[model samples]
Target: MEESNRIVEKTVHTGQQQQQQQMSSSLPATTPVVNPSNPNLQKKQQHIEDSPIANSLPTDHITDVDEYKPPTAEEIRRLTWKRDLRIIPLVFLFFLFSFLDRVNIGNAKLAGLMDDIKITEDQYNGALSIFFAGYIAFEIPANMMLNKLGPRVWMAILLVVWGTILASMASITTGTQLIVARFFLGVAEAGLLPAIYYYLSVWYTRKEQAQKVSLFLTSLSLSGAVGGLLAYGIVRMDGIHGMGGWQWIFIIEAIPTLVLSIVCFIALPDYPEKTGSTFLTEHERKVLLDMLRADAGPAPENDPEFSWKQFFSVFKDWVVYMYCITVIGVIVCIYSIGMFLPSIVRGMGFTSLNAQAMTVPPYILASITILINGHSAARCGERGLHVVASVLLSVVGYIMLIALQGDSLAGRYVATMLITTGAFSCYGSMGSWFTSNFAGRTKRSIAIATINCAGNLGGVIAGQLYRDNDAPYYIHGHGAALGFACATILFSLILKLLLRRINKKRDGLTGEERATIIAEEKADNLLEKHPDFRYIL
Candidate 1:
């Protein structure tokens, strides 16, 4: 009995000593943000963002989750920033053009594509529908290729191809030409977003990803709002006087994309080992890497070679299935910005020009909300509630749109603002949720591709649902949006419950039981060796 008491005392003392050590090591070697300081956050914002490639090592390999691993910290930090700096700007440009080219058909519509191209309304829908056909066919393969090729080569190639397709839009004269240009563009652009998400997983721990992703994704909102304004400005130039407004939108937009593609190739900073000259102060670099090592384990040095066994392994979890369905519902409503906002606005009494003008404000509100929620979630270490709040906000907006009628423009306008806010609010939260919950590069890659494919499928359904006959109110489409938003809320709750069960199962196991659970070590949390470690639910 005395010997057992001694053992317990030693264990207690060892834990106390480790806690003290952690507190001390948490202080930076040099004050972080020691140079490029923001006055308000200079002190408290010691937390840093790493380049994505810095953390390619496995997490469970760390000796202890609670104990500080300084060498590991530095390695992860440098790797993460290297990947982030290279990848974010490149993917940002890719999505910017993908979104702009796909949706600007609406801008062209107002500019007279329908009358000038002699496109029948039915055939116009067919041309628009074909983009997703290509989008669907290529999405998974693009992401799978992204997993294999790495961003430096794959993303740049993706940008060049998509930009070429966008430029080709300026030359299209017939409905068939429009159909082919848009379809091939969709195929070219298909893998970029999934690839970005998969690539981010290579560098960041789940907690670190949201704000960085938010910064890039807000580009989508900007494109939605700005794409039209750009079209408006381009169509006004004197040298372009004889060109159709649609042609001007395509030509001018493609020029910037052409330049953006070239810059992205050189500017992209891939994995940490591949990081260019030290653009970041050593202190800043160090803090960023340490943060992710503390959050998710390091990214694998290189993705494991593809195998049929691994490919089939993605079905082992039910979360992947739930997430697949949840994303389908989430994106159905979320796509309102890209797929429907302009059309819905045009359906109102506004002229084609005025309709294009109005799509800007809602997305401006969306960008603001996304930035705020993304940073807030990462800061406070909370994620799900924000999504719930955002989706509920969307549901309320849809309700107002359906109940309030077009007579109340103020109410309709307010609803539009809320819709953008809520949808993107959830989008910003949801991506990180997937990252935070899943483990392993293989599973993460498959899950990302799966969710994205599911989400883009929503675009296919959403496209056809908004009918010309339902104009002014779009009663059926609005109702479909509402139903899907509600479904998202319920599924989110269900997922929360399942995760709680997962946590409970985790908690009930004894150390010996956990260690003996028969899961593969490389794939399981090595940090499970620590009692306080809990999977983020």
Candidate 2:
């Protein structure tokens, strides 16, 4: 009986050794073995390679198949710098154009778009609100298509379509035609911001993301500044060739987008693994892949097969809904300010051209505040406090707007600067906060789209907030903005406390208890629900 048992054990050992050898032989010839001296690094590398997602990838997609010697920290820094320089600027330019096209209707409105179309104030507000209806409807599907078609092809097509629509707005002579153009314009612009957010999330680590988000989003303010300058210049062309200044605004802004569409097609990188850019060497590519995987764990978008179950799973998380609420509150203020700042300034007694130019300073101040708050939040690794600070600042601004009541032009103008600065600052930190909490790539994509979709309802609210009858005071608008900002602060505090409680509970679990929990999560394919996965507050 003992001899028979030994023979069986020997046979099992031999089979296991053979399987291991077969697996090793399948890898590339130059692939290096994990160092025996560093047990922790070896375990981590094995964990990554043995993950289900990793195993499902094609052999060529595995970064571990390259030489295993990790790059030095300085080398990694240089590679990151090179990657950022190439990627951020191009996407920045694209988003700048996207934002400009979406909101330039405001500039056109001021330059006499409503008069040219003979539209009533109610019809104009309806046109504004209708754009967001198309925008909200198409976000999820557009992001799904973006994943399939690749960013370059998908974004270029979108830009060209929207730019054409914008240019055609110059010819619309009735409110109905303008409304139709605005809706299609919204449809074309839907995927852009969310797609870019997802793209940046894929490229950067959690610690690095807020700063990058700030840089990308600073374009919002920069567009305001540049758009203001451009509007001031273009509106002067009102009488030339019998075209209205509003018509000239649309035509001139549309030209750059059309031209940049061709540039985007040629310039955008698909993904780090699939990029064919001559600028990145094989070593740099491998290092980058390694860094990203280590920092954020496996991304679901990297999975080989599409799962409807995975796509729908994002809706089950309460965190997503909470994020949506906060975003809705923030967007209400932002869209309101974006759409009405010039008018608000004009109501404060500035000339039309001077009002366009005056929009520049507030936007510039907002841009500076966004960068500072984003950098500070990233450095401190605290998202909630930063967001709360920004909201409170806006609350102060709204209060001033209410109390001052156009009594002091300088005071009201300062309030405008505070409003822009405070509201814009929340975007970078808040966006990074929610994005980092999601584990899977598809979930992150859907979460972002859904949040933006829900949040855009704020734009509808914004369109109606400042009525023509309100005129100079607009107390209702100011009060409503103040209410939203306060709501954001409350929501942010609740979320932060909830995350803290959850983290404490996780911290108190025993090793074996945590292990079992992780095993259960893995079995259920719940990536971020693992005991080790802590939410960023």
Candidate 3:
């Protein structure tokens, strides 16, 4: 008995000594309570303390725990600003022209694309729907390529390929040719949206991502406005070099894309670790990485050896399908608006050029709303409700479109503002919401790709909805979009409730039981399924 007692004492003393040594190295500062006055700082400190690395630290080291100082808010701000300056501009520009290239076809239609090609209304709709065939089919493969080749290389390549295809549209003489060119353009651009989401996920934590994504995706709304102004001016060059005004729109817009592709190759940062030393100092890199690990558990290093098991495991998650369903509705509304707004405006008794220019105000307002919604979501740390609210706004707009009289052009124009603002705002919130929930890169890539693939089907549906025959009011299209918007609200609410229930169930577990489950999950590479992982609603 005495010998056992001696052994216990010795073991306790050794553990205490080891902890002291760790405490010495880990927490040299004497500040017991730094930034206690700021609630955000305190919350951040608590978050780090709850992380796996922090949980592994010796609990007996009370002095070390008290003295520990988390990175200051200023440091985080500075590093974030540095990353934003380098990363967002390039990605934003790429998305801008990619979107411009994609939707400029709408502007081209107003510029007499159909008249030149002699395509009937049904054939014109077929051309639009055909784009999403390549878009949906290539999404998974393209994202797989993004995972294999680093984003910088793959994104630059996509830009070059799509720009070439878009420019070639200027030469197409038949409706079938236009359809073929648009399909290839879709194939090249498939990876961009998912890639941008995944790429931003690498740099920022879940909370920070919405704002960054919002700012980046602002290009979606702004591109419409920019496309309008550009189309307005370019269509005036009808006789320039004997090319049609529609040809000029395609050729002129494709120039920026080809030029920017070179810039992307030269300047775009690959990954946080792969970023140049000049861009992020070693110390800054370490600090940034530490913050990431604390927020989400330790992510694998950039370009970790690909695992087939991880790649295939994405199909097991049911939540991704729910996300897929919700986003479909949002995509339908957005694509319909983007593809047909000019036509709709023209149908309201305006000339084609005037219609092209008028599309600008709705898009500009939508951009402002997107920024505001993203900022609000990030600040409040909520996503589903914001999405719900935005979708509701769209429902209201669609109602107006269906119920408002034909001569109420002014009222219909305001309805377009509501629809554009609501549908476009959902992109950033929805992208960040789900992308943040998945942990591993392979799982994230496949899940994003899958969700995107399903969502792009809405593009196909949207193409069919706003037929030329359903001109002016487009009651059927408006009504269908409204129904889908309500569907979005339903699915979003369901997803939010399901995630909350799961989180609540996990919270009910005993500390030891929770620890055991987390260990098992970590061993099996269960990632976001780990008990400690909480989904953001």
Best by lDDT: 3
- Which residue ranges in model 3 land beyond 4 Å of their true spot? 1-73, 298-303, 519-524
Ranked by lDDT from best down, the candidates are: 3, 2, 1
Reference-based lDDT, residue 413, model 1? 82
By TM-score: ranked, best first: 2, 3, 1
Can you write out model 2's per-residue Cα lDDT over 1-537, one digit (the tens) per residue? Answer: 121122223323444344354345334575555677888867767664543223212233444533344344456567778867988898788888888888888888899988877999989998888999999999999988877887789989988999999999999999999889989998999999888888887777666777788888888888888889999999999999999999999999999999989988888877788876586888677666655654543234355344566678888889889999989889989888888888888899888888899999999998999889888877776899999999888999999999996368888999999888888898778888887788777777888888888988888888889887897878899899999999999999999999989889977988678667656555236656755567888
Q: Where does candidate 2 stray beyond 4 Å?
A: 1-66, 298-301, 521-524
RMSD of 1: 9.9
Screening candidate 2 with a backbone cut-off below 3 angstroms (N, C-alpha, C), the clashing residue pairs are: none
- Judging by TM-score against the true structure, name the best candidate: 2
CA lDDT of each candidate?
Answer: 0.68, 0.80, 0.83
Candidates 1 and 3 compared: the better one by lDDT is: 3
> What tens-digit string does per-residue lDDT give for candidate 1 at 166-199?
8778778788888888789889978877877777
Worst 10 residues of 3 by lDDT: 1-10
Q: In model 3, what are the clashing residue pairs, if there are any?
A: none
